[model samples]
Target: MRVLVTEPLSEAGLALLRRDFQVDVREDLTDPEALAAAIGPYDALIVRSQTRVTARVLEAGERLKVVARAGIGLDNVDVEAATRRGILVVNAPQSNIVSAAEHTIALLLAQARNIPQAHAALRAGRWERARYQGVELAGKTLGIVGLGRVGAMVAQRALAFGMRVIAHDPYVPRERAREMGVDLMPSLEALLVQSDFVSLHLPRTPQTEGLIGAHELSLMKEGARLVNTARGGIVDEEALAKAIADGHLGGAALDVFAQEPPGDSPLFHLENVVVTPHLGAATAEAQDKAGTQIAEMVRLALAGEFVPYAVNLSAGAEVPEVVRPFLGLAERLGALCTGLADGALRSIECAFLGRIAEADTRVLTLAVLKGALSPIVHEPVSFVNAPIIAAERGIAVSEVRSTVSRDYVNLVALRAETEDGEVEVAGTLVGRRERLTQVLGFELEMAPARYMVFLTYEDRPGVIGRVGTILGEHGINIATMEVAREAAGGLALMGLTVDSPVPPDVLEEVRGAVRASAIRSIVLPA
Candidate 1:
């Protein structure tokens, strides 16, 4: 395999790839056109934040099978375009958790002890010791948002500092927070009112953008400090700047900005503001770990071995010796149920049966919840806080375990009930492959490929013909089609696995033509 290394990664990471592949290193392909041309002949591409993997780059690499990011975020890559082309997207989400958590603590301590300010004063020959008064972290309340891997690590460190830690992640359970020595606040407003310092650790999404704005800042106590190491837009920069300038906020330390290499902003001129160029994952250890980890994943994928970190695909319960693929199967089933359920989900029922039920299967349950709920909620979730997340959303979830064998070796069934109706999706592990076996009792088996279209209508003699005619007219060829109905003229479900995705407008047209009761087209990980 020929692998292209587009940026500087650790030698430790590059060593793994060099062992089995022909490696090409190009540390100066800053020009998009040059990068595009060079990438055409490679089987894999490795990059850091500087390089952009656009659609043109993917198109150039007709032989490309894997694109690995040596960091947590994939904002630099065109994931949608890569998925459309059936290319695997992999990232190391946990590689930098410790580094980022320690950095957040370092920034908090710097703010409290006035380390940077004091160093500047002493260098400038000003002996103003009284003006450089410092405060202790002991007993101060630290509020954390997004209690994910990084957030939990930060909470642990803050507790070691003798500080009282409180958090407001909508997805973390009360029991989990209690175990971590954090008092879970009901809302962000409650956390702001009680905390001496607030730290942000959320993703940049439509709901989280400008999460800490003027209204939220106004709710905070005067002289309270703010720290953001997550994503830039999570906090409203202008509002934060105003709060600091008006003396309502004591100080703010930001490691990320809404804009990379942020242009002149209101926060730039404030003396109390501390900024870093998005250095959350800047440590040597983190970079090496991320690079090596992603390199191994790419190697496994190219060799047809099961990759544990694949964000878009799963190999089911039976695969190269690991903690069973049942966990991944559960997650995919959760995502499927969440997609089909209507209205807001009020409850979830997860039942584990056969061999999977007899083992310690907490991870499987967590995987299912994370896959199912991540799309609808506004917080970062993991196996540790799945149940807590459900509780916070006012959704009750129940788990039933049984050892009786069923049709498959391991089966995970997820049922969600809402105002619209109840939808149940189930999946099973068959040998080395993971197959989705059932959807609301509409029995069918699919490979869970990246692109799928499901339609339910009255079973008629010409139904399949009409559907095929419309897709052919739109130039969308059917790769595989599965249809199941109880009886003639009865309710039927058709699952169409397509070679390429059906455009939104084309799907709408199909829905109109069939006069269908429900039509859902989505791209799952293949």
Candidate 2:
């Protein structure tokens, strides 16, 4: 295998790649046409932020199995295009967390003390002592916009400076915030109003673009400074400039702009404003970690092994040992829920119970999403694009975890809300085998197979026999079956796996014979 490094990478990473694969370092391949011409021979391509892995480039690299980014973001890479071509896109997301957090603190301190202005004034041979006097960080309230890895680290460091730390992140649980010694604000507006200084540590998504606009900036405490090291366009640059110019905000420090190499802007002339050329992940240690981490990920991808940092894999990667056994169960349950759904899907909720909930169940959740989408969509659905597809279809997805299990030692459940009603399916791993434990509140144990059928009818005798008779008449073989009831003759559910898919007409006949309230024939992936 051969790997191409388009940008500068750490020598350590290059050496590691050279151990198993032939490596080529071409720092001059900055142009897209040049990269496309040189990419055909390599099996893997690695780059930093400078290289743009366009669709044309991916098309030219017929042998490329993976595209690796040494940095935290994939903004320069055409991920969707690569995914379509079956090329794995991997990134070192965690390699720059500490560096970014430290940079945020540096910016916070710089803005608070007007460090850059003071240094510039002193260098210009001006004695400006009282003119450059700044406020102390002690006793100030620091508000974090997103309580993610970097935000949490920033909170820890700010606390060390004797600053009261609070945060606003809907995705973060309240207990998690409390454990971090930070107060969780009810809303962004509330956090902005009370915070003496606000720091942004959020990803740049559609919803987050211009998140802190003029109105949000106006809500902040008078004279409160702002610092952004997360992503560009998250904070409205024009709004920030106006806020600072009108003396509403004391100062602002920006490490990233909406556009790299941003041309002249009004914020450039502000006295208290400090800007850097996107140096949040510029530390030598960060670069080395990014290179080494991405190299290992690429190596794993090349070897067809599990890669924890792969952003586009549907399975193997990111699944913990305990959660690995439940991936199939989760996906099967997802397919079952969708199969049982009566109307258009509106939302999906994945609940993890028992010991499995203690692990990082993201991969399992992704499996569920992939399963839910694969059956209905015209295009292919993988773990990498399931979330995106769900969002595009306006389907809300959520995950809930609990360490306590009511019956099984571990359970993965999927509840999908549709326009008509909701359908729920739950499953668990039983000694390396998958078993369906619950379906729409009906509790029964049955192994899931490639072909399965579920039916709801009156708890009457011979209902199961009649269904079996119909299946037998249609030449459908029942592999396993289970019947659960709410009461003696009130309502009951029959679930069974078949050796072959039950014909649609045969399923209808069975439903009519048993007078089933609901019937669904589901076909799961092998």
Candidate 3:
């Protein structure tokens, strides 16, 4: 196997890759056409932020099994195009968290003290101490927008500075925030209103792009500063400049911009604004970590093993024979549980029971996460980034192994705890075919399908018939149906797999006709 390195990588990483595979370092392939020409002979390609792995380049690499990024962001790589070509994409997400957190703190202090301005003045042989007067961080409230790994670290550092930390992350549990010695606010507006300084640590997703705009900045406390070290395009640069210029905000600091190498922005002209050329992960230690971590990931991908940092691969490169049959079942169960769940999802637990528990079930857990998050999140969820996406949304995920199974030889159970209540869905393989075994503690046998409907209602003689009638009237055919009840005249659960999606109005009509307490129409991936 041969691996190609397009950009500068740590010598440690190059040595590691050279151990098993022939390695080639070509730092001059910065042009897309040049990369495409040189990529044909390589089995794996590794790069940093400077290289753009375009679709054309991926198309030219016929032997390419994987594309590895030494850093966290996949902005430079065409991930969707690679996935379509059955190429694995991997990245080192944990390589730069500490570096980024420290950089955020450095920028925060610089902005608060007007360090850059004062230093420039002193270098120019002038002294203006009063003009550079700055505010102290002690006794101030710091609002964190996204309380993921980097945000959590920033909170700890801020706490040591004697600053009160408040955060707004709907996906994070209040208990978790309390343990971090931080207060979890009910909403973003609430945090913004009380915080003396606001910091952003969110990913650049469709939901988060331009997250902090004019109105959001306007809501901040007067003279409150803003810090962004997470990603470019997350904060509205123009709005931030106006906020500082209008004197509504004391100052702002940014390590990233909407466009890299941003030539001239309105924010650059403002004396109160501090900017860096995206140096959040520029430390030597961070580069080494990123390079070494990505090398290991690429090696695993080449050896047909499970890679924890894979970005596009659906499942592990290798799977135990015994546990292989349940991979799809676990994902379907995850999607089912998520679909049936009500209110906000707080936590998800995956339990591997009986014989399957004996095998390495980490890939199966990743399958569940991918299934649970794919329907809701804006970006595509893969076996690798599922857990990260869950954490970002404050959704807790856990897994357990149990050798004991009540009935089936192997069972995969997915339970989702929502704000309203908990919903559990369990599945098993029946002679190589996936089947739904239990839902919400009600056990019934039914084959999983692309479109399904579940209903909870009072156990009555005609309730099931009423549901069937409504679906049939709408030209929806039921492929399979199962009903489970506690006892006579008790609460009952009915599940059905249909030939096509049941429209919402039709579901509503069925709900009313059957007088069902709850109903969910789920459309799972084929």
Candidate 4:
């Protein structure tokens, strides 16, 4: 297979790809047309932040099976367009964990110790030891936000520095944080109030944008410093600048700005502020790791094997063992409702209960969107792009967090209110050690494998046999089937596991003949 590696990736990442395919390595591909034209014959394409895999590039790469990013952000690539073409997109998430974590720590130390000011004063031939006096890190309290990979690592390093570290991450397990010797704070306000230094390691989202505004800055101890090496716009730059100018806060060191190559910001002129040109991921070690990881991901994608670090891995074709077949519960549930007889969706709500609630629920939410929107859109869908896709299609999304669930353990419900009306469907994580679950409020629980037919019909004695006969006649054999009913002759749900994908035409035929409320063809991971 031919693979195109665009942008400067590490030699290690390329070595893995080179072992299996003919490789084209280019440091730049700024011209979209030229890149598109050259990428047509390649089976896989790899890129960093510079390359743009637009619709043109996607369409041109007729044989393209995968597009891998050497870094975390998907903003550079057109992920939705790729998904529509059934092209797998992967990224190296763990490769840069250490790099980012270390950078956050470095910025924190620089701000706390006033290293930049001290160095500048020394270079200016001024003894100024008293003026540039710094504080010791030991015995100070460090507050960390968003306890993902980077946050956890930052906590570890801060603890080693003899600083008491406390963190606030709604998603992380309390036990895990305790094991790491990091105090888990109840809220952002609590962390800010108690910390001598506050650091951000959160993702960029609407909820997180400007999260550290004037109100939050006011909560910090007067002399507390702040550091941000995560995404730009995560902190209110304007608010921070005002706080510093008014002597409300001590100082700040920012490695990222709301805008890259910032467009004339006041923070640059401040003597108390230390800024870097977004160098959090600039280390040679990080670049090499990200590149190598993407290369390995592409190798697995080409070979039809599992690729970890996929932002949308749970939603995509590759399935891991822990969740097993239960992963498909969200996808199938989405498919059952997206294609069903309903009005447009005014709002979409997802509920995570029991064990599934304990795990990362973000992937589960995206999986539902993937199965629901795959048939309607023309591109590959992703977590980063899922919300965007829904917005464009005029759908509202709402997620519910609850642990008040038992027996079924984890339950996912999608409610769609279209022009026709509003309809709600729910599912849950079920089955034994191997992991199987029921989707779409169905009573049926089966191993998550490919090609299943989910049918909603009037509860009746002969409906199952009639549906079975229709499938058998169409050369579609049912591997397994289970039914759930509200009451006899009332509404019922059935999950039919099949050997092959039930073609759309065949599904329409079954829907029409059986007079069922809905019928959808679904493929899930095993």
* Tens digits of lDDT, candidate 1, 447-504: 7766678889888888898889999998888988889898989999998878787776
Instruction: Please estimate how well model 3 matches the true structure, expressed as its whole-model Cα lDDT.
Output: 0.87
Candidate 2 per-residue C-alpha lDDT over 412-497 given as tens digits, one digit per residue, 9 for 90 to 100: 88888886777888888889988888899988888889888989998987887888888998888999899899999899988898
Regarding lDDT, does 2 or 3 come out ahead?
Answer: 3
Better of 2 and 3 by TM-score: 3
- The candidate scoring highest on lDDT is 3
lDDT of 4 by residue, 144-182 (tens): 987655677888999999999998864344555677888
| Rank order (by lDDT, best first) | 3, 2, 1, 4
**What local lDDT score does residue 485 receive in model 1, on the 0 to 100 scale?**
90
Consecutive 10-residue window with the lowest summed lDDT within model 2: 376-385
Q: Give one digit per residue, the lDDT tens place, for model 3 in 1-526.
A: 9999999899889989989999999999967899999999899999988899999999999999999998888879997688778788988877888999999999999999999999999999999999999999999999998887789899999999999999987656677788899999989899999999999988785557888999999999999999999888988888889999999999999999898878899999999999999999899999999889988999999988877777655534677788767867877888787788875578999999999899999888988887787665433455767888687667888999999999999999888898788988898998999988899999998999989999999998888778878889899999989999999899999999999888779999998888899999997755
Cα-based lDDT at residue 30, candidate 3? 68
Q: lDDT of each structure?
A: 0.80, 0.84, 0.87, 0.74
Q: TM per model?
A: 0.69, 0.66, 0.76, 0.62
CA RMSD of each candidate after superposition: 8.9, 13.1, 6.2, 14.8
Clashes of each: 1, 0, 3, 16
Best by TM-score: 3
Looking at model 3, the pairs that clash are 171-393, 171-394, 172-394
Q: Which stretches of candidate 2 lie over 4 Å from their true place?
A: 315-412, 415-526
